[model samples]
Target: MSSGLPAGVDLTNTLLILGGVGLVTLLLRALPFAAMRYFRESALVAWLGIAMPAGVMTVLVMYTLVNSTENPGGIGAALIAVVATAALHLWRRSATMSILFGTVIYMLLVNLVF
Candidate 1:
């Protein structure tokens, strides 16, 4: 079967492409930690350290809710999971607990009820 890749894009090129992507991703992930020492005392960095997690979580929740609408049947389960997650977070103030329970709830609902 044909791969449909452009001519000249063979295994070597694919490996190189993947390696480049992996290197870029690794660097991107490590860049923030690497720069943290330099920005340790900066006010902006301090504020971001406190704020970025909430901002990122908000973005993720919005993305999940928006995407859930695309699958009509699963919307209820998604909403329930989000609500349960938020409530758990508010109640227990544990990120790990909230996320784990929320995921388990979502999976169960999707698999069994939805």
Candidate 2:
């Protein structure tokens, strides 16, 4: 009988490696929360928290526009999504709503229309 192993690798060894990786990932993810509980946020951190979202959104829009410019439909779809996102954000002042609407429009365009 064959060992309980993959085609080329031992299953037990692979599972041990996977378990170690999973544990390390879990610990790393928890580290930020643990540290936050112990330390107060600095002014720089607070400012970044407030400003980074808008900055990141702007970068993402620019990236999408630049990357999709090769195809006319892609450019048009991206522009429509960007405008919709901006309008939603302006009207409601909610980033969540803006991003959600924009993402939905973009996905629909790419999948069905464009």
Candidate 3:
């Protein structure tokens, strides 16, 4: 115990505190899914489930492209990734494949190509 301290913090207490924090974080993350399950039949919930992904993705794409101008890559990496994503999605009609290919292309360009 420190000077005048009632009880000193030790490994046990520290681990307990961290575990409580982790549990809280897990519950917080799961809250949205719990709500979704409870509101599955609500029209607003159904609309958001269908529309939120595209809306969020569009915002992310815009953010990345807008931020790419500050670097020396001439926006090539971002542009290539965008094109790859669009092309793959258009050709295969699969969001997962499009996003995967786009991410790979961006990483390759940033690490090796440009």
Q: Score every model by TM-score.
A: 0.66, 0.82, 0.77
- What local lDDT score does residue 83 receive in model 3, on the 0 to 100 scale? 91
RMSD per prediction, one decimal?
Answer: 5.0, 2.3, 4.3
> Scored by CA lDDT, what does every candidate get?
0.87, 0.87, 0.84
lDDT of 2 by residue, 1-114 (tens): 687666889777888999999999999999998888555658877888889998998899889999887754678899998998888888999888889999999888877898
User: Which regions of candidate 3 fall more than 4 Å away from where they truly are?
Assistant: 1-8
By lDDT: ranked, best first: 1, 2, 3
Candidate with best lDDT: 1
Task: Rank the candidate models, highest TM-score first.
Answer: 2, 3, 1
lDDT of 1: 0.87
Compose the digit string of candidate 1's lDDT tens values, residues 3-86: 787877787788899999999999999999999899989999889989998898889888878888776446798899999999
Model 1 ranges off by over 4 Å: 1-33
In candidate 3, position 111 carries an lDDT of: 80
Off by over 4 Å in 2: 1-3, 7-12
Question: lDDT per residue, candidate 3, 8-77, as tens digits?
Answer: 6576777799999999999999999888777878998889988998998899889879988875454989
Q: Which residue pairs of candidate 1 clash?
A: none
If both were scored by TM-score, which would come out higher, candidate 1 or candidate 2? 2
Query: Which residue pairs in model 2 clash with each other?
Result: none
